[model samples]
Target: MDWSKSKSIFIIVFLILDIFLYSLYLNRHTEAQKVEVLGEKTIEARLKDDNITYTTLPNIELAPYISGSVKHFTNEEMQAFNNHEVLIENETKIIVTLDQPVPITDVEDPASYVDFLQTYIIDGTSYGLWEIDKTNQSATFFQRINNRTIYYNNHGMVKVYWNANNEIYQYEQTLLLDLVEFEEKEELWSPIQVIQVLYSRGLLKPDSQITLVKLGYSTLVQFTQTQVFVPTWEIRVINSSGQQEEYFVNAVEGKVIDVQFDQSKVEEDEE
Candidate 1:
């Protein structure tokens, strides 16, 4: 009788239901993708084709150490202690007295003092005890990445000075903060790859041999909001006349960056 008509109606209703369900599924999927995109860490990278694309992935966040013990100096205290600040581009200079005078004997043991500094004073996780030179009455800690130590006078450094009275009179630190590193450090270009890039860029001389390659952090660019340091490949090369030259390479982007050395510090140290 009307069996054929009922069957045709049933088929159309099922098709409508299928289309509605499919639309709902697509909407949910699109929403999920948006959430994922928001949570991801994205970096712009130039491809071989000379086009930039966002490489989104998880990354390691390395921030400067500011402990609860580090208190901001008040105006009266600054005046009393003779505080001075010299601001230069991305670098900030702060010379203020501590809440309590730190003793030299407390930090004379290099390793233990270094640990204390990390917990209370210095920022960044890329440092290890390098040397304790009593002649200068100071301890020198070098910035490091794994087993590879960064070249001298670059990256985060802590130079703490103590007096004959065993009182830690002063401490100096140059810190690069808020660095983003590739979670999969394996993704960084190898030392050989960086060397090739350097040679291609006419930075490395044919007669020069690379002396050391260290992984560290270098300020890529500075923003008003924050300072961003890139995971850097610091390579030192020695030439015919025994001149040692250092070059910096961005680990993630594989590009060479012009690094400015603190030559004044070198000269001062020589004095």
Candidate 2:
């Protein structure tokens, strides 16, 4: 009923609202500034203090998560290849034995090995050479999507077994089907962030040398008919004792993945 009294009350209410909004803005600004500064320096300081050394981090900025199902090989599809005895297991894998062993003319040249695979193997172009186990006279290849390796997916890989003659006698293959990327891409965590994650979790020992750093995808979830993949960083480190280990970090989520543990769990679930 009193006009002046009502005006004064409204002014007081607006003043309180302004103060509340400004406080929220200040809090958010401070947090962001801290992140910007800490993200650049804190990780480096921690890594140095822990006596960890790494190769240069990549300049990569953005990446996307992807998902796909494992291919189910039908007889019709499996019958396409020649000169090899192809066997389909559970309609999901191709196990092949060459009627006669193919000589790998150059054991030292990795490109030569890839050539052999592309010539005699199905979906060879879809795989990237992973490792050559000289002790076992074998080589392993991992399936690739978007030109990036899918690290150690059981359902999507090739294992080539060679005789002492350095000839490929047999190889098994699997593939991912209907690969699709998510519409929304993510800003990946830089290599520094990934390393810091491992160090903070006590995964990286002091005086460790990171010998290899690569960008790839690892299994995110395994469903009965499909599997989801996410961008990950594969770091190979050698400790002070000269022992080597590999670690995977989820690029988007910044979580370290115990690859061996996850692989074992997957196998157990399948069984």
Per-residue lDDT of model 2, residues 133-227, tens digit only: 88888888888887898887888888898898988899888888777786667677788767765675577899999988888998766765566
Per-residue lDDT of model 1, residues 47-154, tens digit only:
222221111222333322110011222344335333333222234323324555566445556555754575545453566776677788777766554544443534
The ten-residue window of minimal lDDT in model 1 covers: 262-271
Task: Using lDDT, give the best candidate's number.
Answer: 2
- In angstroms, the error of model 2 at 121 is 1.7
Clash pairs for candidate 2: none
List the global CA lDDT of all models. 0.48, 0.74
In model 1, the Cα lDDT at residue 126 comes to 64
Off by over 4 Å in 1: 1-126, 129-157, 161-168, 174-186, 261-271
